[model samples]
Target: MNMVEHPGFVLWFTGLSGAGKTTIAVALEAQLRERGMRLERLDGDTVRQGLTRDLGFSKEDRDKNIERVTFVAKLLSRNNVAVLASFISPYIAHRDGVRAETTHFIEVFVDAPLEICAQRDVKGMYKKAFAGEIKNFTGVSDPYEPPINPEIHIHTDQETVDESVQRIVTWLEERQYIPAKVTA
Candidate 1:
């Protein structure tokens, strides 16, 4: 599987915290890797620990965060590396900026009700946000502007992870972004 034969693209997964953005991205990454694609997964939490460690959660800081990630994704995707990015990128403008900067950018909206996301919060961040302990939290103190038209929309509350991944993979194949899976 020569990666150069496959064009690079960026799969940007955006949703509320605890909405399974990272979970689905991880599953999709593994499936793509099994196909022998050159890939990289840029996660919000992980990137925050390194690349954007100096940034905070404010809107200005958040914009800066996405801008930095967009730069990295642009470089990787242009070089034939599949980029899987999962983030709680709440602003439409910021996401649009990424789409403009990256190559073959696909916006994947991981949709789930706020209540459902709150229930899935094992880290208690949502609880704190709801209680006013955590300030500037998207969907609580801050606003999360959902995508007007995402390339892929996954309902995390209704769909299983496998189902979501299959849907995404099928889309990529249909669009000729990725080759169809070869089964034995």
Candidate 2:
């Protein structure tokens, strides 16, 4: 198949807030860009300010947020643009719904224990959630539904960003969604 002539796949990275979902996605995006592939990223924090500003952190709001992002990803992927999404979409139903919405979807579970995520929280989300200052926070007050049999699973706490990105890249290459690495 001519990957360049066909629509690209949707890559969904899901995990806790500090589980390095965005970090790995950003690194993967950089790697994809370096290889001359056209891709777009839709991050939770970045989209919340625009696409989902009216939504809150409630369960319904979270589902709606995922729906919106999935809608956008569907459009882009249909047009041959690789849509990379980094979200703490803590619901399995919604994630599955997103998978159904795209032509090709890869669910990447960025895994890290809650303790490690808490330690990596630079925004103090974990601290605030632990202190009762934040409600409905995944891995704290709220719940996180880990991906069941995800396409790729990366333990961010156990791997560096580059390693995580390489894992994702390898998956894409194996499926021919992106070109394989060329040797010098």
Candidate 3:
């Protein structure tokens, strides 16, 4: 019997809120689907509401949250399912821990200026954070340790969503994460 190769992996996106992480992740997933790849997405907000419902926003809680997500991502990857995760993931140690779990891990940093992220805050999170209604908020009350050597960096403030998606797709193609296509 021919054994199927492990097809699952993770494209881990780290960024401050309102940095367009979710937007770009959804777009990337759609692009991958167009190429017939099976995938699943794990957004920070959605996971917090469910799997991480008991967790708080303290630094320790944030670390635990990422730990849980990393474990789940690894499990999914082992099953041959592509996993896309978008989270603030403020600490470099947390991200490094996640990276140690799988060879297919790709860290994509969605880099956007704090002002741009504040302006794009459709959820009013930045406003609340600035007003002190929220505390320990990343890029506001808390620090976000930017990735020093991300596999891909999307400067969302300077690029269109489609352009960002294309950049990620190009990287995946170049790295053989996804199969190369043929053209007549």
Where is model 2 more than 4 Å wrong at Cα? 1-6, 182-184
Give candidate 3 misplaced runs (Cα > 4 Å). Answer: 1-6, 181-184
Kindly provide the TM-score of model 2 when superposed on the true structure, using C-alpha atoms: 0.94
Summing lDDT over every window of 10 consecutive residues in candidate 2, give the lowest-scoring window.
1-10
Ranking by TM-score: 1, 2, 3
Candidate closest to the true structure, highest TM-score: 1
Q: TM-scores of all models?
A: 0.96, 0.94, 0.93
Q: State in Å the error of residue 6, model 3.
A: 7.2
Q: Name the lDDT of candidate 2.
A: 0.88
| Candidate 3 local lDDT, residue 181 | 47
Which tens-of-lDDT digit does each residue in 23-130 have in candidate 2?
Answer: 888888877876667789999999999999999999999989999999999999988899899999999999999999997999999999999999988688888999
Q: Report the C-alpha lDDT of model 3 over 1-184, residue by residue, as the tens digit.
A: 2222336779999999999889999998877776667688999999999999999999899989999998899888887888999998989999999999864889999999999999988699999999999989999999999999999999998999999998998888786777554332
**Residue 133, model 2: Cα distance from true site in angstroms:** 0.4
